[model samples]
Target: MAGNWNNLQVPAGVRDLLPAEAAALRELEQELVAFFQSWGYQEVLTPTFEFVETFQAGSPAGDEGSLYKFIDREGRVLALRPEMTAPIARLVATSLRREALPLRLCYSARVFRYEEPQAGRLREFHQAGVELIGAGGVAADGEIIALAVETLLKAGLKDFRLGIGQVAVTKGVLQDLDLPREAVARIKVALAGKDLVGLERLVDEYSLTGLKRRQLELLATLHGGKEALEEARANFIQTGAAAALAGLEEVWQALTAYGLEKWLFIDLGILRDFDYYTGIVFEGYVPGLGVPVCGGGRYDGLVGQFGYPCPATGFALGLERVLMARGEGQGGGQGGYLVAGRDLAAVLRRARELRRPGVMVIIDGESQNRQEAAARAAARGLALVWVD
Candidate 1:
């Protein structure tokens, strides 16, 4: 009778990172950490699972049903982190209070989100992000944008653009309409998708004036280049949404002073899906990718939700997407010098001597010739280093 057994397979939306691919990812992450560290951004690691209440501080638990959750032995609900920002905010409020102003923290971790997996997207994904807490000025905003651009450049990404927008603009436009909270939420969802038809339908249902309808339509078109901002400015003046226009101008001027004007474009319609984000928001995109590889913006009120009430801004980059943008292929295999020979003792000794942290793997056999041994080593993804 056949032996009873179970198939060994990872869950859907998750896969093993093969040897060479794992190495490539490690290299990329190390490079990013080093780059961020050089800029005085100290790295921090938060727990993989946090108490459910921690994430639900600002939003209802029912709203985030996609999160993986369970009740601990203590009877407290817990969840695998779906995102890092909330946990980091809690940390700042509780542990890092005594720390100095303008605290810079960096992190690299896996975030879980229950979503349909696709190319460059996985349910379990790695994210590297930094947060600047207590800094609440355009200069700080500009600095964050500049750092993001520099980080992507260091990661071997070219032909990328930074789409910048202020949430205040979208919020302001909706506020001017005096819509109810429920209606505002629906409008936000439509705007986030860049769904012009949906937005127009909602506007019509609400009986918005011709000017209000035009303004809503214009938000979708407020993307591309400098001219877009100018057009938005003119449109806002006529519609009396001057405050939103001014916020955009502040961000634009700050970016220009930081010498990042060329890298950014105004996207008034850029609405963050998360309600936590307030003020300026930005996302980094490269050619050939439909989704943003990196995203963050001012969440000046996020910490406030955690009882800290500190203003802050941050961004997170998807490691897989960055690797794809750099054209780095998957992990190949074991990466070390391979030693093969009939004299097992000598080969073992040589391998031990060469093995420090990242050098040497021993394979012993006399049946295979030098060429055969080299072929075997290559197949195993090891570099052949012969022993005399």
Candidate 2:
């Protein structure tokens, strides 16, 4: 043990998935891919890591600090992506600009973040999501939201809630408060963490009194159905929350048309990664999980930062959390080895003949007697022994 110096262990907060779990994940990913494709969402892929400056544009409260960063060979800082929306926006602006307007792109990618490992939190995780680019309306937003619900239902989840919010409602509150930049940043950090005490302290620290103080407190509780929207509209109309409110109402109407209203609720307190999300934001949650299995929303101006201007909205579902919610069921059941005794070519031919969609027929590695071959085949769950 002492002489073997090359450690084969992976870093903390990451793990190697065994065969069963890996196969299950692959199956789930394929289901999502097929679902997204069915909705006319074309697939796209981006780099696992990119230049550090890529994430620095109008950065969110904690995004910059949360990145796993390092210096490249050329002395440029590169970071494993902490999220996909920004990078997808960059992709739309750079490479795919000439394709068309109102692009529908989906991706299954591994994103990295330097967060402590816990139940639903991982340093490395896979995200399956879509970005609706060049689209600016409630219909697009509603379509994305509806697609998300359908995907989850297809994944076999029975119970969950979708909490939708308009970030503009909160932004309007911040705008009206007109707190200093530092103060606004503090409030964002608190809100992103859903920390009410922190919000109260920040309000007091900034000497935000009267309407501003009351509004911030109310924002924390502004989650639920139509009442929440009504309250938000009433409070934020004077503060320029009208557009966001209208957009939320429009999307609700569309979602209603899709008969998905029962699964959705409004939460004006819902502010996501702050740098990009310009409008409606939503998160999907299920029982027995402390974190949302899926979350995303609108980012109207993200692509513009990459030298092209377009409005976009999308969401990424956390695959690990999804599998957690779904649980480890029976392993993937398939045919096992087909041992070739005397006639290897004939065995191979038979194996090929036996192979079909979603089924496997593996040729035995070496020649064996019929008894030995059948024993080995039976050991591997293969009922029939075809040894010629």
Candidate 3:
């Protein structure tokens, strides 16, 4: 038999988070949980994986295909969770069936998606998010955006802007075009990426009129202050998409009432890839980073897909992305602690007592000296906390 050392490393686009990295991530998760809790949002944990059908039910991000799939003992098709919102919606419809209205829930979990991983993008990434269910209208939307802003602020991120958009606005434009559902979906994807060429090709394929074409082109640039919304209204007709735009206006008004307008920018072109989002959508972006640190929106119809009807809005902050935006990348004082001693009991007790909910390693070896132990720990990306 051939030796398998050649394939010993973890798969590409996947990595084992070292001690310090894991510790920093945990601290970030706890901070987010506490922030959500302070706003009366209770934390909840969903399973790491679920049935394939659960994820297939109307994903807005389009058919990216399943990231992780496996056949269980029962031979059922299962997949690693790509996102948390769908599971939370399922929870609300089933487990929390009789729960009170205006339910607020928060969760911090790793979501898996098979994609090219890069800085701030991972095959397995942790997301901290909150959902407010059973709440309708613009006030709920405003509150969700406000909470997102507050959460980032608590995370010590100051040089970031929240780009706000109303999916309704995009829907409204599509409604006036008389385009097929497939065309609209494709157009939305193109518009979401600000892919003007793709969108123009879509417009040509659909034979949209000059007016509609102009409206679609303008949508890409319809991002800024209040004036951007006004510009969109002037160019687009009052169709279904316009009705959605109206909802966006209402949300903007509510945000103003709460004095949170400063933290928000109106971007009518914004569209999250998730298929479930139905109304207002927003994302947080820093100056240099190419992607948003956080992104979310209203998904009022999601629960209905799971056998219930409840309005809801939520946001998910990518902890790793936030850390990167804040200039704290992978390697730092983040992970584990090295506790070494010949007397195992004493070392274990000391490590336990000093453990602060992050990663920790307790080394039990009689021959290794303190310096050797410290060096070993350092080499493994852990801090040296000798206890003997």
lDDT of 1 by residue, 136-207 (tens): 877778778889999998988878999888777767777777888888777777877678889889988999
Off by over 4 Å in 1: 1-9, 57-62, 237-247, 332-336, 352-367, 378-383
lDDT of 2 by residue, 218-293 (tens): 7777777777778778877777778879889889888988899888988777787656788889999899998888
| Residue pairs clashing, model 2 | none
Q: Residue 235: error of model 2 in Å?
A: 2.5
lDDT sort, best first: 3, 2, 1
Candidate 1 vs. true structure, TM-score = 0.88
TM-score per candidate, chains pooled? 0.88, 0.89, 0.84
In terms of lDDT, which candidate is stronger, 1 or 3? 3
Off by over 4 Å in 2: 1-8, 178-182, 197-209, 329-342, 364-382
Give lDDT: candidate 3, residue 279: 87
RMSD value for candidate 2: 2.8
After superposition on all C-alphas, the RMSD of every candidate to the true structure, in Å, is 3.1, 2.8, 3.8
